[model samples]
Each structure stands twice: as C-alpha cells, then as structure tokens.
Target: MFYYYEKDQKILASERNDLPYAQGKPIPGAPIYYLVEGDPVLGRGSFKVNHPGQLKAPHGLEVLDASRLPEFPLDATLSAALEAGQLTAVNTGQVGWESVLSAAPSAGKKRLNILAIGDVGSTLLTGLKLLGGGVLSSIGICDVSDQVTARWEFEMGQINLPWDYNAFPDVEVVPVEKLFDCDVFVFVASRGIPPVGSKVKDVRMAQFETNAAIVKQYAKMARAANFQGLWCAVSDPVDPLAKTAYLESNKDENGNWDGRGLRPEQVQGFGLGVMNARAAYYAKRDEKLSSFLTEGRSFGPHGTGLWIANSIDCYDEEISRELTQKTVTANLWMRELGFKPYVAPALSSGALSILLTLRGEWHCGSVFLDGVFMGVKNRYTPAGVETELLPRIPDQLFGHIQEAAEELKRVL
Candidate 1:
C-alpha cells in the first residue's frame, strides 16, 4: 500500500507508480482515507471503508482488484479508525472531491425548507416542528397556494410549550424563489395520487410520471440558484425522483450534460424508513417473524419493488417472502379503510429520517448505488456519505436487492 498527504490529510492508495498526485510515507496513528477511483455512473460512490466477507469493484471503477489486497495481519489502527468512522474511501473521480477534503465538518443547527403544504408535507412539518429544535434553526414552508402555506404557518406556530415559546423551531412561510436558501431542501410537492377508493394498487408508482415532472422544475431552479444543501425527496416514488433531481440539475439550458449541479451524495430519497418501520410493526405480532425486529433490513423502492429481509444471519426465504409482501402492501391496507396512508410515512420516512440525517446518525434512505438510487442503511459524515457494509448478505436477499435496482433503472 502507498500513502499521500494533501493539506495535512493522509490518503492511502494501492499503487505508487503513475499516480496523478504526489506520494508520501504512511503516518502512524493518524486518521487515514483510502484513495479510490469512482465511476459516477456505476459506482458505490464514496463510503466508509469496511471489511466484508466478499468485495467486488463497482462496475467501471476498478483500480487494484479487491482479491489482491492483503488478508492476514489486518491493520489494527485502520480497523479502530473504521470503527470510529474516521476511514473513508475518497472518490477522487467525483466532481467536487477537492472541496470535500478541505471543507470543515458540518456542525451547528441547520435551516430547513419544505416545498408544498399537502397532506404528507403538513404531517412531516408537524413532526419536525415538535422534534427538530436541537437540529434545526428554523423551518421554511412554501407552496403554490398562499392560503395553504399561511394555514400551515399559523397551525405550526400554535404548537409550542406555554413556558418556552422558543423551544421549537419557528415555522415561516417563504416565497417560492427563496426555497433553496436553507441547509436542507425537502421536495414533498406531488400530484396524481389516486384517491382512497381508486382501483390503483400501486399508488406510489402511479404518481411517478407526474411527480417526476414536478420535481424536475424545482430541480432546475435549484441548479440556477446553485443550491448547496441536502436535497431530500419526500414525494411519492422517492427513489427515482431523487435521481431525477440530481440528473435534471446537471443539465445545461439546452439539456446538454454538465457536472456543475448537485453531487450524487447531496440528494437522498427518504422512502425506505417507513418501509423498515412497517416490517418491524409486523414482526412484533408474529413469533415466527420476530427475528426481523433485531436482525432484518428493508431494501429497494417504496412501492412494488420493495423487499424486506426476515433476518440477515438466519435468513428464511419463505418467511422473508411473506414479510416482504406484507410490508409492500401496508399502504394498501390503509386505503382499504378509506384513508390515504400518509401519516406514518410522513413521520417515519420524511421527518424522523431527515432529523437523523442532520444529526449525522445512521438512517434508512436511498442513496446512489450503481447508477440508481437504491434504498440502504446510510449516514452522512464529514468526508461524505457512508453506507453500511455488512459482514455478509444472504444470496437470496442480495438477489432481491439487485432486482429492485434493475426495476428502478427500467422505470427511470
């Protein structure tokens, strides 16, 4: 292995010859980052380096093969550093990597802006106002209808403790032009949701085409404003919409490709959290499925392509298949009762997961993986976005995840 240093940051690389930059000797006991080339179109992006049972180069980003790396005598210091979240793979190929290396860690409360005051948006706003005091300085609301935004502002303003007027983050109605002027921009504006009694089985997917067009407009606006905050996709069909925002923002006025917009790591889809929560809800009721509560995971899109693992260690194909079906159809259960299932999703996926993200904690969100936004357990760090690398994933479960990715690719 070889090492390099730039501006006091240490980097480890597999090769020393023909490196684009200068090389340096390894520094003992200091935080280190692995230098790797990443393909923006087909790579895992940047993430915290971990030791899994198997490693494969993300398609098109191969440098030194994973099999050639040393297996025995694992560096204790590197392992410890990884445990402390200090070791990350720096994707030098990404557009804005240099700034990431030089940028300071993000601290202090963040300002959040929400677009749309619809059912999901309003419910999510309520949850954030009640619980985001420590992480959010304020919340900005915007919508097409002035009356809607005004109603939410008044409703949110009344939800405060009598003794502590300033205990919660204040909610203010913001103009459409200033929506991007915050640390986080959430896109909850959606259209074409099937009514409760409608025959649409997959409601999320039904809204994709209309919602995709809506998000693209705001995405270009963000590009024009040079938005530099986290972009959260909270509307229906969250995964593909997140990718749409990232892709649409990177195009020129004539629709030519450019790399000056939001980076892949900057946009995340918040649809998996509620799916994960639903799996747990079912696991608590059945003894045969109880293992999911502690050892399972949710993967893929929020709708038809979603999958739930019954247990990572003791994976049961039959039980997992049953559980997956239940979780995927949980929203339909509410629709049968003459109601749209927006409350749990708003709280679980939109508000709680976003707060966890701002706090730099592990959360369920769809991140860029091999040219698509696939749901996974991920968290943000000073270096960049870091995804969980399990010791091993069951073959069947892994297959389901890959299938989910392929489905999303087909849709988008």
Candidate 2:
C-alpha cells in the first residue's frame, strides 16, 4: 500500500481506482506515493516534504510488514518521471520502508555515453574520465571523426597507469549504433558556434537554431532505439536544445506527437549549473554580498533569462539583479579576453553537476516544469526529482523565474 494527498485529505494507492495517480490536491504535509511490486521493493519518485513533522501515511496504506521488503534503490530514470509529475512516493509511516526510501541507495555503477569531442566535449570528457570513477563503471565515446574518438580513447587510457588501473573508469570508442546503450547519453555535439573573434553578444543563444537541428537527429535515434537512459543536453542554449530533444523524440516521422519516445523529464539541460557556479564566483568576490555563499540560489534558463537571488531569506532586488547580470554575462568576459568560454561550463555544468546527480547530491540544473524545461536546485532520489522548496520565495525572484519560463516557452 502507498499514500498520497488528495484535496488536503490523505488517500491510499489501493483506495484509488487510478492506478497511475495524477497530481491531485496536495496534502498539507504528505509526499505523493507510487507503489510497484518487483524484486527491488523501491519507491522511485519525487516529492517535497516541507512539513516533516506533519508527515504521515494515509489510512489503509500502512505496511505492517515492511521488513520483508527489499532495499529502496535510487533509480534516475524513475526520478525523471517524478520530475515530470509522472511519479510520487510512499508514506512516511510505512515501517522500515520509510528509512529505506529515505536512504535512496545507489542504483549501481552507470554506463555513460558521450557524443562529440570538441572543445567543450573534450574538456568534459577529461573531467568525467578523471572524476567519474565512483559512480561510472565505464564511458563510451562517439564522434563524427574516427581519429577524434581514437585519440581520446588512447589518451584517456593512459590516465590510469597499470598500477593504478582502478583510478578511473575505462573509456572506449562506441559505434554510433551503440550510443544509446548506456545509463546516461550526453549530447555535446553542436554546430555553428560563433568564432572566437566574432562579436556575438549572446554566444549561447546564437547557436540555438543550428544546435536544435542537430539535437533533433539524436532525439529521433533515441526514440527509434527506445532509449531508457537520461538524455542530457550540454550544448549552448542548453535548455531550449533539451526541449527540442524531448519534443522531437516523441514525434513521428511526419512530425506528429505520438508519445512513443522520450518523456519531457527524461531530457535535462546542463547549462544552469555553470550559471549558478558563476553566481557563486561573483558572490565570493564581493564581500557585501557574501551572504549569497550560504543563502543565495540560482534559477531559470542558462542564458539572458537566468535568475540569481542574493539570499532567499533576505532577498534584495537590487543585489539580485546585479548578480543575475554578472552571472549571465560571465561568458562574455572570456570572449573579451580572446578565449571561448568552455572550461568552466564543461567542468562546472557538464562534469561536476553530472557527478553530483549520480551521487544524488544537491546541484543546479534545468528540469521539466509545467510545460517548459526550467532550471532550479534539484537532486535525484529514489522518490524522484526533488526540487528545493523554500518556505517563502521572494516575489521579485519568483517573477524572474516565471518570466524566464515564459521566455523558454517562446523558443519551441
């Protein structure tokens, strides 16, 4: 039995005729629940339990013998479903089940696949190769150029000497046909990136059209293969490109929505992590806004619409606007220095955030919200994609997030 809140009243999964529950009237303080029977007695979904003291399973959903159940393992795929409002979680009063679900043990070592190996992709590969040992069993790389794949394979192979063979996950060239045979498929391939000397004010958005077209192809491939892994968008204008992947995947060849492929939540944009990191960078530099290091938060898209709050507890519109501008324009500073801004994005947004996600740690990234892919602080758990919910969100900051969501909707 599982518990969920309906119309401010607790309801049990067995009580509802709805097998797959809809997002109903939320209970004042209960996590939505999903109950499935399998070898792994896990509840993989998402919910925000703000009032833990008030948390309780609805009547008739109590598991009197939860000790017989298996461990609740974290499943990222189900977490994606939860984020899309496609899933929920079990009750807090369900005996050993509550502790098992809360622990959210690792699913297992994941197999990762990456497409492309350009400036950003190569840098991202380097970081993942060196840092993904704990969570990744191995990495599969694919590129248009055989030499590019071969070079990286050989280079990455040397990272761990024979004596320290276990230091890093093994890297290999994966044929394009086998790209989706992994737990995570990162789309780093892009076209029409502005040249270093080019004077494009918004570098990320400038490549939107070209990258969208490129992402559509992979999206179709994922659909055709019935991919079960994560679809990660790491290109410029990341949020829009991720939506393209989701929309294109679910459409038929005639461009009709058949709902036969990737779900919106399964595809995520990895750009906002860098934006948040940039905000922290600027916050640390300015002593006046040092509170940001502890209480500040980043939200919305990765480009011009990005939002940065100085402190959610003590919101200052003036300070937030200043930080937002700095975070969004941080990439331009690299261009002014005659460099393309790939290092920070590849490391902070691409590698570090992905690692944090595999470890189920709090990180900033874009996830599907409402009808659009929006960035927010979220973490993966057995219960699903849990977005950070605050007691009181500032009106000014919320306005920015809403505006950014509107701007993103305009793109697709």
Candidate 3:
C-alpha cells in the first residue's frame, strides 16, 4: 500500500506511481481513507473495508484493502476512527473526488428549497418549517402552479408560535428559475400516482416512468444552474429518481455523460426513513418481533424492493421476513382504508431524514451503491458521505439486500 498526504488528509492507495495529488509522507492521527477504483457493474454488493477483523473490498477492487498494508497495524486511534466512521473509502473513479479531499467549511444555517407543494411536498415542507430552525435559515417553495405555492407560503407563514417569531424557518414562494439557489434542493415533484383505490399493487413503481421524466427535466436545470447543494429525492420511486437526477445532470447536449454535474454523493434518495419507521411500528406491536426496535436495520428501496432485518446479531429470518412484509405493505394498508399514505412518509422520510442529513447525523437514505441507489444508514461528513459498515451481516440478510439491488437495477 502507498501512503500519501494531501494537506491534513491521509490517503492510502494501491497504486503508488500515478497518484492524484498525493505525497509520500503521512500525517499522524489524521483521519485515514483508502482510495480505490469504483466499478459500477462489478461493485454492486457492499463489503467490509474498514471493520475490525479483516478488510474486504468490492470485486476487482480488493487490491486497495487495508489488510494488504506491509507493516500498518490497527492501532487505538485507527480503531476509534473506524468505529466513528472517520475511515472512508474514497472512490477515485467518481468525478469531483479531488474536491472532496479539500477541506469544506460548514455552511451553518443553510437555506432550503422545495420543489412542488403537492401532498408529499407540502407535508414535508410543514415538518421542515416547524423543526428546521437550527439547521435552516429559510425555506423556499416552488411549484408549477402559482396557487399551490402561494397557498403553502401563506399557510406556512401562519404557523409561527405566539411571541416567538423566530422559532421556526420562514417559508416563501420562489420562482422556478431560483429553485436551485439554496444550499439544499428537494425534488418532490411527481406525477402518475395511482388513486387511493387503484388496483395497482406497486404504487411507487407505477409512478417511476412519469416521475423519472419529470426528475430529468429539473435535473438538467440543476446542471445548467450549477447547483452545489444536496439534491434530495422525495418523489415516489425515490431511489431511481435520485439516480436519474445524477445521471441526467451529467449528460452533454447529445446525452453523453460529461461528469460535470452533480456528483453521486450529492444526490441521495430520502425514502428509506419511513420504511425503517414502519418496521419499528410493527415490531413494537409484536413481542416476537420486539428486537427490531433496537437492533434492526432497513435496506433497499422504499417500495417493493425493501428488506428489513429483525436484528443484526441474532437475525431471525422468519421473523425478519414477516416484518419485512409488514413494512413493505404498510402503505397499501393505508390505501385499503381509502387514503394515500403521504403524511408519515413526508415527515419521517422527507423531513426528519433530510434534517438529520443537514446536521451531519446518521440517517437512513438511499445512496449510490454499485450502479444503483441502494438504501442504507449513511451520513454526511466533512470528508464526504460515509456509509455504516457492520461487524458482520448475516449471509441470508445480505442476500436479500443483493436481491433488492438487482431489482432496482432491473427497474432503472
């Protein structure tokens, strides 16, 4: 392994000869990161690259494993960094990776902008306006319909607490051209949602084609505007739409990827939080599934492709499968009662998770993995996006996750 230091950051790479901007010396006690080439098709599965025991890497990328270091030892500081998620694997294959190595000053009290004030968007906007005072300086709302944006702006303005005018983030209607002006741009514009009583079993997937098209249009707009904020996908079929935003924004006029638009780490799908919440809801009601509340984790997409683990350590496949079924169909249970399940999703996935992201806290969201946006527990860091790596994931549980990724790959 080759150790290099760029400013205060320390990087270890497999290839020593043609390094990006790395030097030979390493800084003591600084955060350690392993640099590896990312292969979209072959790197579909997650691996344990920074865990305690043995380091693993995605297929064709194991040459950069930490275990291959000649004399490097997992000392106390390095172990602590691993547990704290400070140790990351930088994808040198990604565009704009050099920018990630540079120190980024915190943009305290950011401005947030929301597109479309429909059911999901409006509810999410309300949650953010009420709870985002510490993280957000202001909230901008934009929609194709003037009446809709005007109504939400007026309604959100009336939600201030008595004698506490500055307690919440103020909301205002923004023109379409200025939608990406803020530090965070949330894409909540969706179309072709099946009605409450529609016969469609997979509502999220049903809206994908239409929603993908809508997402592409705004994605290009974000490209043209050179949007530098986090792009949150809250529309139905969030995972694919998030990928669509990243892929579309990077295209040239002839639809060739130019790698000049939003980076993969910048686009995140905010649809998994509600799935995790719903799993917990079911787990709370069933004593047999009670372990999920603390030890469980949700993986994959928000809809048909999602999987839930009852416990990471003592994973009960039967109980976990049952819980997964309940969580996956929770939205359908609401539809059966003649209602669209938008409120919980908007708040749990869209608002709460996005707030956690802005605060740089651990949150459940779909991040780019392999060639698809796979939902997982991830957080933003000064270095970049860091995903949680468990000590061990049961083979059965991991298989379900792989299947979920394949399903998403087929859809996109």
Query: 129-191, model 3: which lDDT tens digit per residue?
Result: 999999999999998899998898889999988999999999998998888898899999988
| Predicted structure with the largest lDDT when compared to the true one | 1
- Model 3 scores a TM of 0.89
Ten residues in a row with the worst lDDT in model 2? 58-67
For 235-343, candidate 2 gives per-residue lDDT tens digits of 9889999888877887889998766667554678899888888988988899877778999988888897888889987999999889889888888888889898999
lDDT of 2: 0.73
RMSD of each: 3.3, 10.0, 3.8
User: On residues 92-112, what C-alpha lDDT tens digit does candidate 1 reach at each position?
Assistant: 666665555554555789999
What are the TM-scores, per candidate, against the unseen true structure? Answer: 0.90, 0.79, 0.89
* Stronger candidate by lDDT (1 vs 3): 1
After superposing candidate 3 on the true structure, give the runs of residues whose Cα lies further than 4 Å from its correct spot: 5-15, 20-24, 29-34, 40-88, 103-105
lDDT of each: 0.80, 0.73, 0.79
Candidate 2 scores a C-alpha RMSD against the true structure in Å of: 10.0
Error of 1 at 56 (Å): 6.7
